[model samples]
Target: MTRDAGRPVATPSQTVGPFFHFGLTANAALGTLAKDGVRGERIGLRIRVLDRDGPVPDAMVEIYHADAEGQYGQAHFDGFGRLPTDGDGTCVFETIRPGAVSTRADGAQAPHVNVCLFARGLLRHVYTRIYFSGDAALDEDPLIALVPPARRSTLLASQPSGEPAVWEFTIRLQGEGETVFFAL
Candidate 1:
């Protein structure tokens, strides 16, 4: 049987635009459950999400990580979170240091947080990894090893001068320090 002709051959992907804040930002205001009851060493991260010209004033951030003991996923303690950036394109996440998880390859993965970025003009969210400079096992991370040495620093968060357990990292969408995004 022949089908009707009036239809889109493929649905176009929706791009983030001028009004994404109304929905995603509302969730960010209430997304910090880890700030209160989780275990392990707590950490506060500050990040600036940037595009080619400059900072993305209204970017959104999402993260997933394992618990202090490397266990993750549960209704009671889901390790997922979302945060919206301020006008300065800065976002913060308060959570505990993620524990290392064993890989099928050979060794355990280094302690790190997985991040997803959403901002205006992006047709799809971008993915990246964040590693703590304070981790003693940082050098052994398999993922980090995959990146070139020169660009690897972009993935590691460093502690600020006077803030204990606080780390800083900037996400550059393009140009010189563009962050390395994973395919899947």
Candidate 2:
């Protein structure tokens, strides 16, 4: 039906964005979760974001976890961190290894860090969990049981053979070896 031609067409849809370095800084302190006097096994977490094309330098990563006592809401540790990826698609966090948090079922959960990712192509941020490699509690965690055996490795962060205190996790947005993101 040809009516009055005074209406404007709607704008085309677009991805989240490419706001890589608008307000982010390279400050190392922003990613530090462990403060002075906070006690635990000091460790370094290295996260990498990738896609089929290559590294996602503009991505931002956030993490939250409990303290060494398997507790949260402590006065010493805030247990939260946020950092932007660098040119190598990497962000490093200096945090202590968290203790195993207990579950509602009276069972212990694996020591893990909760992660959130935000990047240009995503309409909304994605959520995931980073479990430490060699944690015996992984066998009993209820959530880990839900994931398939072959894919469970995607949720684990591994310590390089020579780097005793450094753990690395890679998030692949597409193609092979993609990290397992959670629904919530």
Candidate 3:
């Protein structure tokens, strides 16, 4: 609220409570379209959404990864996927591994998926990347190298027990160990 002259004035504000999913979600999370019609080393991923207060249910996560050759816009793969969290604040994706991508300014980026997160209490969407944990090139990836060392681990996705090519990761939207968010 703001004071105008002698009386209190209304201030504009917005919150990501209940109504955001309607516009941004087009039943994208209802199925596994991201994995359809592609052939390569298939990988499964599970992401848990958390915040300072703990589990954040109904959050939406969108991801994009390059094809096997680190190229995009392929005839067989669209390179984009979207998923909404379950009541337990869990989201899953089944997509092929992305090859390394090169950037003129940053050199090369390790195999990873770009992600966007949307949920209640956020003013706007949060953007981040999910890098494969075992990548030897992770330390020098242009984007990963730019991030502070301590926080870089938050962006990595680790493989779970005995799950052949499956990976797991967690996203902390705020508070301690919050995941990094790019300005863009």
Model number with the top lDDT: 2
lDDT of 3 at 150: 96
What clash pairs does model 3 have?
A: none
Checking candidate 1 for backbone clashes, the offending pairs are: none
Q: Pick the candidate with the highest TM-score.
A: 2
Q: lDDT score of model 2?
A: 0.90
Deviating ranges (above 4 Å) for candidate 2 = 1-10, 25-27
TM-score-wise, the better of 2 and 3 is: 2
Model 3 stretches with alpha carbons more than 4 Å out = 1-12, 20-37
Tens digits of per-residue lDDT for model 1, 1-184: 3234965466556677746577763665445646556677888878789889888988888888887877778554577888878888887877777889778887878888889988888888899998887687777888888999998888888888889888888999999988888878
Cα misplacement distance, residue 140 of candidate 1 (Å) = 1.8
Find the 10 residues in a row with the least total lDDT in model 1: 1-10
What residue runs in model 1 are displaced by over 4 Å at the alpha carbon? 1-14, 28-30
Which prediction has more favorable TM-score, 1 or 3?
A: 1
Ranking by TM-score: 2, 1, 3
Tens digits of lDDT, candidate 3, 131-168 = 99979979778788889999998999999889978888
How well does each candidate superpose onto the true structure, as a TM-score? 0.85, 0.91, 0.84
State the number of backbone clashes in model 1.
Answer: 0
Q: Each prediction's Cα lDDT score?
A: 0.80, 0.90, 0.82
